[model samples]
Target: MEDHTAGHNKEKRYECDVCGKAWQQPYLLKIHRRVHTGERPYVCSICDKSFMRTQELKKHRRLHSGEKPYGCSTCGKRFARLSGLWVHRPVHSSERPYTCSDCGKGFKLSTDLKVHRRLHTGERPYTCSDCGKGFTRSTSLLEHRHTHTGERPYTCSQCGEGYIRAKSLRAHQRTHTGERPFICAKCGKSYTRSTSLREHQCTHTGECPYTCAQCGKGFTRSTRLLSHQRVHTGDRPVPSTVCGGGLAMASHVLSHQRVHTSGQPYDCPYCGEAFDSSRELRQHRRAHAGEQMLPLQQTFQEHAGAAGAPADTHQRVTL
Candidate 1:
């Protein structure tokens, strides 16, 4: 059995003169004594940054060297420190021990639990030193600092993919793994993450919650509406993907070619007949099943009313 320090050493001993408190370990007491003396012995070679503890200085140096020695054996995800890998491993394992007191949202790490607590408390302590923008956590402030510094140190070895944060890098690595954890309970549509799955679910429900102020068009996902709004604002995309075909939305690239094609690749499972568009295929399936068509003009009018847009503002056909 391991020695029980609390049971054996109950008597007060090794007291700090500054705080009038005792310590279990003399090494811890010695380290605590440095606060009174204002001594930071451990120094970095790259930036000459100093830390009270040697371990803290060692971790700080890894930020400069881009060294992630600790790696997950299962997912091949890497971390600068073992503690970070410890926190990250649970995501792969789907182990959520920590939960929110307010909403009962489960999280793997205690740090995530603390960050989630801010939703209940509304406590923002970490304010940006440069811009005075407030964040609930110190990690958020650190990420916000990257915006000012424009530092994206994390670069992928495979495809030279870059990210501002380590967590984003981890998520980007999943693209190679083909691991889609989030699945739609209703449609069986799979996504790499829960957020994407939620957005995909909205398409089936016909729920376009985000409204564009300029065109008065509503989108199911906020990201979609944000991208659509860019069309008006003259925000051209950086062209991540290349194609010979001229298309607007990346999602419509495969579907839009039906205007010229003789063979319809998309087929109605109910009738086994091919259709030009997926929407047409859906309508065809409904027709075979003896379902009445919702009045297209009336549906467009309802959608326009919901988006706070005039029906004549944009030439939109309801499918």
Candidate 2:
């Protein structure tokens, strides 16, 4: 009754000197002080992972047990925790109460809006202790630490392949299932990933959003744009292991290594011809289709002359 009266009266008697955060109960204050002290009392027996709270340790155990007790009332989607289900509930509705002042982007939760605002402000509160890399979120910082520790917790049951992230494991599982969930609305082409679908849609719309500042060459993807920029700068970050030759892209290094070994691993389905690289195999396939093939360097040279050309006018290069 006294605890209820303290909460009802908004009287936080127990206060933390470290962060000046007050709690109604002494036990609640003790739990809150763990954040500042970096103390984790609860430990998972399965993974030997430690948590500050017993409830958090109980939730972490669900990952090993695969126990999803919380179910969404709308879509019947199951979650390990009630907070996950609460976060997902907004997805069924169009309502986004939280709005960003900088970008005018709407989010379902105020916490999401706060995170989105960090992008505009260039505020990265979380920092890695090893490499000193900064991230906008604590989760990203935690993931970055895996690189130093080489800890891949997520694993595939079929292939025994391990991944640092759960999302990467889920995407890899799609290859075995042959699940192309994302579909192109115009051409009806399907892809395993949503980003692949968005890149494919750019081909239909002729949208080359990523443009080169030097030659004004537009590319459908930022990766392609970065590769093209390397051509102008003569910046070959990837080095060939065999000859110690610098290559613009990592794929080029693989192709270069095959030259030393005289290896032709990529075989053509149409013809019995083999190529050292997948790019060569793809270009060779176009020959069977009777499609006019333009040399990659020639295409780049031609586009380089036409500076500030319209995005629609830029030829799409599949690299």
Q: Could you give candidate 1's per-residue lDDT for residues 153-256 as a string of tens digits?
A: 67777888666777667667779888777799998888876668877887788666677776555566544675565444433322112112223233332233
Extract clashing residue pairs from model 1: none
Error of 2 at 260 (Å): 8.4
Model 2 Cα lDDT, one tens digit per residue, 1-319 = 9987766899788999988888888999999988889999899998899999998999999999999999999989999999999989998889999998875879998898998888778888999887576778899788767755657788999999777777878888999999998899898999988778887887888777787776565676555776666555656555444334345554343344444355554533222244767788677646432343223443321332344433332223333
Backbone clashes under 3 angstroms, per model: 0, 0
What lDDT score goes with residue 43 in model 2?
94
Range of the 10 consecutive residues with the lowest summed lDDT in candidate 2: 293-302
Which residue runs of candidate 1 sit more than 4 Å off their true CA positions? 1-12, 24-28, 64-69, 95-104, 120-123, 129-132, 145-198, 201-319
User: C-alpha displacement of 93 in model 2, angstroms?
Assistant: 3.8
Winner by lDDT: 2
Per-residue lDDT value at 64 in model 2: 96
